[model samples]
Target: MLEARNLYSYYGKSVVLQDLNFDLEPGSMLAVLGRNGVGKTTLLRTIMGLTDRTKGDLFFSGEPLGDRRTDERAMMGIGYVPQGREVVPRFTVAENLKMGTFARKDGKRAIPDKVFDLFPILKEFSERRGGDLSGGQQQQLAIGRALAMNPKMLLLDEPTEGIQPNIVQEIEEVIQTLNVEHGLTIVLVEQNIDFARRACDRFLVMDKGQVVVSGRGEDLNDEIANKHLTF
Candidate 1:
């Protein structure tokens, strides 16, 4: 559902992503793996039009995305859960989720039952402030907020990062369900190789802002990890 060719993304004068290339098919999961500062996060940001500028071509569902603004892309059905889980700290759980619906083309303000179903804790704490939640709960809230938009695709940046073990597993299962059962296309920027290998059908490794290795999930073996993914 997403394609990039010779993509270069920049923050002012410094180019953060250089000549990146990838294709994400509909109803499939693609893993983006790389060590710290290799431009994995920037790839997602570029797709969302958060960067200062981008060069080359980016397409979503056969339409050119370079000219589309950030909110326009959201209306086009791309959901982004950035690395920091940037929920409004003052907003209640319900309010935070409602914010996502602002991007919906349908103009519906109702939070999806599917979102509450995936993360039951969100429903339980609907009135709690976002800042009052634990790290795992906040991550859940982040994902739930994105789902509230009823997006066609999800871009997740380290959804498991800093989360406790139990919630990590829960979050992983939710990601699996979203892709396998719900058929939401995913572009995941993840640090966990094992989970990525199991959950993704396609995988790519990047270094220095460019794709260094890419293939089917089975090709993401230890050799490739040691060579391109090790810290």
Candidate 2:
């Protein structure tokens, strides 16, 4: 449902992504893995129009997304949960989720029943300020905010970064259900190897700003996973 061909991007004067190519099938999960500073997050930023692409093409749902603004991309069904979980610190959980639907073509806000079901913690803490939540709860709130957009393709950057292990497992379970049951297309960038392998269907590894190895998740052998991911 999403494809990047020969993508190249830069931050100020230094190039961070070069000739990167990958694809995500509709309703399938694709994981981008590597140790830090390998362009994993850069790839997602370029795709989302958050970073400028010097060369190459981006296509979503078979339509070219060349030179679109970030908000335009979000309106087109590309929802992103950035690496830091970038939630509004002062906003309540419900208020934060509401912001995601601002670009909906439909006039009314479309809150999916499944989103609340997937992250029941959101309902329990609906009125709590985002900054007051635990790190794991903040992460869930971030993902929940993205889901409120009803995106056709979701781009998640390090969903398990600093959460406790058990909470990471809970997040993983929700990711699996979103893909398997809800048929949400996902392109996940994760540092946690075990969590990525368990939830995604394919893996794309990056090094020095380019994709170095890629294969089915089931075939993500120990050598590559450990070599490319071990810190």
Candidate 3:
């Protein structure tokens, strides 16, 4: 559903991603794994047009996304949940979710019922301020907010970071459901190798701003992890 060719990304004068290339098929999940400072986050940001500058080709569902503004890309059906879960702190849960629908091409503003099904807590805490929620709750809210956009593809940066183990499992299950049951294309930057192996159809190990090793999920074994991922 998405393709990047010879992708290079920059933040100001410094290049952060170099010659990155990958393809994501419809209804498939790709796990991008690397140690810190290896440009994993930049890959997602570049895809969303959030980087300072980008070079090379980016195509979504066969159409080239050349010089498209961030909002335009959202209208094209890409939802991004950045590393910190950047939910609007002061907004009520419902309001925050509603904000996502602004990017919908159909101009519909209502939150999708599937979002509530994936995250029942969001419905329960609809009236609560986002800033008052616990970390795990906020992460769920972030994902639900992205889902509100009715996206075809989801770019998640470290969705399980800093969460409790139980909530981590919950998020993992949700990711799996989104890919398997709902047929959403997913590009996940994840640190948890176990969850990546369990949830992803394919895995890419990046180092020094490039994809070093990538293959089907079953091929991401101990040797590759020890060589490219071990800290």
Candidate 4:
């Protein structure tokens, strides 16, 4: 559903990604793996047009995203959940999810029942302030906000990072359900190798801002992890 050809992304003058080429087919979940500062998050940012500049071409569903703004891209059906889970702190849970529906081209403001179904806690905490929630709850809110747009492709940066251990498993299951059951294409940047392999159909390993190793999920073995991913 998305293709990158010889992609290079920049933040101000520093070129963070170089000559990257990858394709994510429809309904497939692809994991982007790497150690810290290898441009994994930058890849997702570039896709969302959040980088300072990007060279080469990015095609979403056969259309080139040439100089498209971030909001425009969202309208074209790409949802982003950044590493920080930037939910509005002042907004109530219902208000935060409602903010997501503004991206809908149909002008519908109603939060989808699927979103509430996927995240029952969001419904329970509908009246609570976002800032009052725990870390894991905030992460779920972030994902819910993205889902409120009802995107065709979801870009998640480190979805399982920094949350409680008990809630991490629940988040993992949700990501999988979105891809496997709900048929949402996903590009996930994650540190957990075992979960990546189990949940994703394919994997790409990055080093120094470029893809160094890539294969089907079964191909991501111990040797590849030790060679490129060990910190």
List, residue by residue over 19-137, the lDDT tens digit for candidate 1.
98889999999999999999999999999999999999999999999989999999999999999899899999999999999989999998989998899899899999999999999
Instruction: Give lDDT tens digits, candidate 3, residues 60-108.
Output: 9998886999999999999999999998999999999999999899999
Range of the 10 consecutive residues with the lowest summed lDDT in candidate 1: 222-231
- Model 4 C-alpha lDDT per residue in residues 126-217, reported as the tens digit of each score: 99999999999999999999999999999999988999999999999999999999999999999999999898999999999999999999
Global lDDT of each model?
0.94, 0.87, 0.94, 0.94
Error of 1 at 125 (Å): 0.3
- Model 3 Cα RMSD, 1 decimal: 0.8
**Which residue pairs in candidate 1 have backbone atoms (N, alpha carbon, C) closer than 3 angstroms, thus clashing?**
none
Candidate 4 collision pairs: none
Question: Worst ten-residue run, lDDT, model 2?
Answer: 103-112
**Ranking, lDDT, top scorer first:** 4, 1, 3, 2
Q: State the lDDT of candidate 2 residue by residue for 89-196, as single tens digits.
A: 999998998987775657458677887898999999999999999999999999988888888888999888889889988998988888999999999998777777
Model 4's alpha-carbon lDDT is 0.94
For model 1, how big is the CA root-mean-square deviation?
A: 0.7
Indicate the worst ten consecutive residues by lDDT in candidate 3.
Answer: 63-72
